[model samples]
Target: LVGSATVLCTDKTGTLTENRMALAQVWLPSGEALTLKHGQPVSKDCRKLIETAALASDPHPSDPMEVALHNARGTFAGSESSSTLPIHTYGLRPDLPAMSNIWDDDQALTICAKGAPEAIISLCRLSDDAAQKVLKAVEDMATRGIRVLAVATSTAPDRQWADSQLDYHYTLAGLVGLADPIRASVPDAITECRRAGIRVVMITGDYATTARSIASQAGIEEGEVLTGSDLEALDD
Candidate 1:
């Protein structure tokens, strides 16, 4: 452990936090924010947003013939979205929520939220603006060692009912992000890495501000990260 270094690599999509995106705010096309929860009857505003998201989305359901459903989300190697399936893609589910119109996995639920955080901070109904604040709050939560995700969903119709294909109104519930206190084993690992004189670097695509926020939470100070542009300048 003296002169050599071992590269301990990791993927960040979710292992750092929880794996499903949660619904934060429901912004109506007419510019109103609303909230909808499972088992609770849908609100007029929430239904509007969901209907629009669903109308604009293309959800690929789980069918027995599709062999790629078994693969993990975001990994397209042997899966459908490698340009081979012609119509398949997967994204990170930040706050995984359950709803009747939504498919469980491999399917993208389309429910868009809108608003200015400053305008909707106090409106419990919800707003895009408020959604951002909620996200900021999650970031704040992360600073305090909590993990978080943004969850939102759209519904066409209950899959269990007559026609799951029919598009209907949808709603925006609320935000769901997750986090946990720094685990005990991490300190030992950090100590080991330091003892070996190894430095672990974090690479992220989040905005510099967010990345810095996360870095500080993970005990990395300085609040600065090198972006591709920064790296280019360094090469010069």
Candidate 2:
């Protein structure tokens, strides 16, 4: 943390949530990993949702959808070499042995994932209690038509060696929904900037429709908005 304090702003893509997301949190307490090719679960609720996130998603294992987000977040943070990538210094592959780009202990829950809220929620296999919680989260986010990503991760130890890459089964972490998700570290830095007395603002390249939708989710009041051209004219 820094010694300054001021308003902080950030994006909501991966910065607030895990890069690799899951729809459901079916914990194999038996110490077994649950693997699904798609969201093909016997349970109606679980199967339906998981299928959607996997199928509807535009991200491949490693590609632009992920990189474009990282690139944009880098610019926001003013990170060096971010013209290529911001907070992430090296090449990142979500499935490989890597820690998340976003690692903030404080306000972990507030971290959000944005893509398709409906698609993200479908991947979860919920118990009665867990289902209610997920549903509440989904409803709260959806009513605003905010794009949400159900953030979930399965953890294994660093040294745990396995014969197959598929040895580990994912554990359900939590659901992080972002109207317009940023890189995972964006929230952390934004929070830090606020604590350290810096100004945080959002300027986007998207059309007004999507840009405003996501901005609202990032906590801007729904009213006047400005575009890139607007800035150019002001300079005149």
lDDT of 2: 0.37
Q: Candidate 1 on 1-236: residue-level lDDT in tens? A: 64687544433334333333333234332334433233445455454334333322233534211111122112211123232121212222223122232333335433332122221232234566755656565455444332332333443333222232113332343332222233344545656775776765656644455556655555443434788679888843
Candidate 2 least-lDDT 10 residues = 82-91
**165: Cα error in model 1, Å:** 13
TM-score of candidate 2 versus the correct structure, residues matched by position:
0.27
Tens digit of per-residue lDDT, candidate 2, span 97-192: 222221222333111122332222332344567556655655554444333344333223453333432343433443323233444455466556
- The number of the candidate with the highest lDDT is 1
Per-model C-alpha lDDT, please? 0.38, 0.37
